[model samples]
Target: MDPREGEFVDRMGLVMERFGGTRTMGRMYAWLMVCDPPHQSLTELAARLGVSKTAVSTVARQLELTGMIERVPTASREHRYQVAAGGWEHVMKVQFAALRQAVETLDLGLAAVGGDRPEQRARLEETRDFFAWTERDADDMLRRWRDSREDLDR
Candidate 1:
């Protein structure tokens, strides 16, 4: 294995662990995202990630199901894996939409309070507003990120 690739995989594993994914899974995803070839065979992924091909295959399949990676077909019948372009954007959109549902739940809780507690209702409304702000700004934040990516590309 390349020493440089080892360093990259180690760092990627840490990032994946932070993001609630397995270390190898994170490393595999990271490699797929930025490797020079833009795609990796299962053997290559396993070698780089310091795991078995079967392990890489499992993680790759999971990421593929999540739309984070895709399979490329070649005339040789060998498969290569690549990180899906714009996948992070799609993931963020889905995550923010889920968060919005939490905000709605908070609103429902605020509504359940009886008429006698105006002060408590006000506080609850404030809490609800916080989530509301997040929901409202989620799209803008994603747009800004997309714009920044475009700027980087240019």
Candidate 2:
């Protein structure tokens, strides 16, 4: 693998790991995102990610089910996986949804467990606040970047 691709794999691995997913899955998804043709056959994805074809198939299917990716129909029998065309938009949307779900889970847990549990509730509150802040900050940054890009284009 190219050095740049390796870096991409590593970075993606960190991102996925931080988000409660496997590092290998991150590398696999990142490879599909940046790879030429923006798609890969199961065999090719396996070779590139240094995993088994079955593993690639499993991961690819999971990603597809989660709307992170999709299958590209081909004349050949083998299936191909690719990053969604909207790319970061799609990925961030999923991430945000997951974050929101986590917050909702925390809410339910807090309600069930009661607010008297100071330590556990503190942790949950911290996590909820962090994700909420991150979501706002990311949205603001993206908006500014888009505005700047639009200005440059004019």
Q: TM-score for each prediction?
A: 0.80, 0.64
Local distance difference test, per candidate?
0.83, 0.80
The TM-score, computed over Cα atoms with residue i paired to residue i, of candidate 1 is: 0.80
True lDDT of residue 138, candidate 1: 93
Q: Which candidate leads in TM-score?
A: 1
**What local lDDT does model 1 show for residue 104?**
83
Against the true structure, whose lDDT is highest? Answer: 1
**What residue pairs are clashing in model 1?**
none
Clashes of each: 0, 0
Tens-digit lDDT string for candidate 2 (38-106): 888999988888889988888888778767788999998989988875455656766766767777777
Task: Show where candidate 1 strays beyond 4 Å.
Answer: 34-36, 115-127, 152-154
For residues 1-154, could you state the per-residue lDDT of candidate 1 as single tens digits?
Answer: 3678768868988987887778988888878766879988998888777799989889988788777889998777667999898777776787788777878887887878866889988888888888789889999998899899999999
